[model samples]
Target: MIIPVDQLNPDTLNQVIREFLMRQGEDWGLAEGHLDDAIQQARDALVQGNLVLYWDENEESLTILSKEEVNQSGLG
Candidate 1:
């Protein structure tokens, strides 16, 4: 199911984004500053509709994914 980012509370939104970024490999590097930048980018994408929040029923998990990922996954 699609979830609007606005539906999440501020704290929950922050935690969800943080967890996703942490698992995103080395793309954002290890520096605190760079991590912030990466997080901002993701936030921008979400606001711009380039990325979206999804709730996967089977896994009972929430995830952030690119529009392409949603389309390719046949879930869009």
Candidate 2:
């Protein structure tokens, strides 16, 4: 399911982004202090409609994905 960014609590959204960034840290070579920047970039993408928030009911999990990815996967 597609999750609307405006429908989520700000704190919850930030936490989710934080977790996702932590997982991506290796690939991003993200330093501890640089997390905020990364988060902002992710948030910007979300606001710009370049990224999406997805909720998978079966897995009971949420994931952040690119708009193209969602379209390609037929999840949107």
Candidate 3:
């Protein structure tokens, strides 16, 4: 299911973003010093609808994905 960005607590969302970024590592092409910038970008994408927050019931996990990525993957 897709959770709207505004619906999540700001602190929780921040932590989630941090975890996602750490997991992505170099895949996101983000340097260590640019973490704050990257997080802001991700937050902006979510608010602008360019990205989405997905909840997988079976996995009991939350993932952040681009709208195109979700649609193309048939997850949207």
Candidate 4:
């Protein structure tokens, strides 16, 4: 379920991420500012090289998690 970083195309990844955030906003009924903050956090994680995208087979979804957490869980 965990996808390798090398396997993803960056553009597709970005699009998926954008959609995920938008969906989250709608699902949670978040305000614009709150959604913006969440988006910024995601961007910061990527900038810090602390997060990666993975494909969850069971859920058939993508997720972002800290690198350390991923490694600790033996999912990397």
Where in model 3 is the C-alpha error above 4 Å?
27-29
What are the Cα lDDT values of the candidates? 0.83, 0.87, 0.87, 0.68
Could you report the Cα RMSD, in angstroms, for every candidate shown? 1.8, 1.5, 1.4, 4.3
Write candidate 2's Cα lDDT for 3-72 as tens digits. Answer: 9999899999999888888887864448656888888999998989898999999999998888999999
Clashes of each: 0, 0, 0, 0
- State every prediction's TM-score relative to the real structure: 0.85, 0.89, 0.87, 0.52
lDDT by residue (tens digit), candidate 4, 3-75: 6545668776666656667766654335555765666666666656677777778888887766897889988
What is the per-residue lDDT of model 1 for residues 21-72, given as tens digits with 9 covering 90 to 100? 8888376563554777787777888888898989999999998888999999
Positional deviation of 40 in candidate 2, in angstroms? 0.6
Span of 10 residues, lowest total lDDT, candidate 3 = 24-33
Residue 9's lDDT within candidate 3 is 96
How well does candidate 3 match the true structure in TM-score terms?
A: 0.87
Candidate 1, overall lDDT? 0.83
Error of 1 at 40 (Å): 1.2
Q: Candidate 4: where is the Cα deviation over 4 Å?
A: 1-33
**Cα deviation of 5, candidate 2, in Å:** 0.4
Candidate of highest lDDT:
2
1 or 3, greater by TM-score = 3
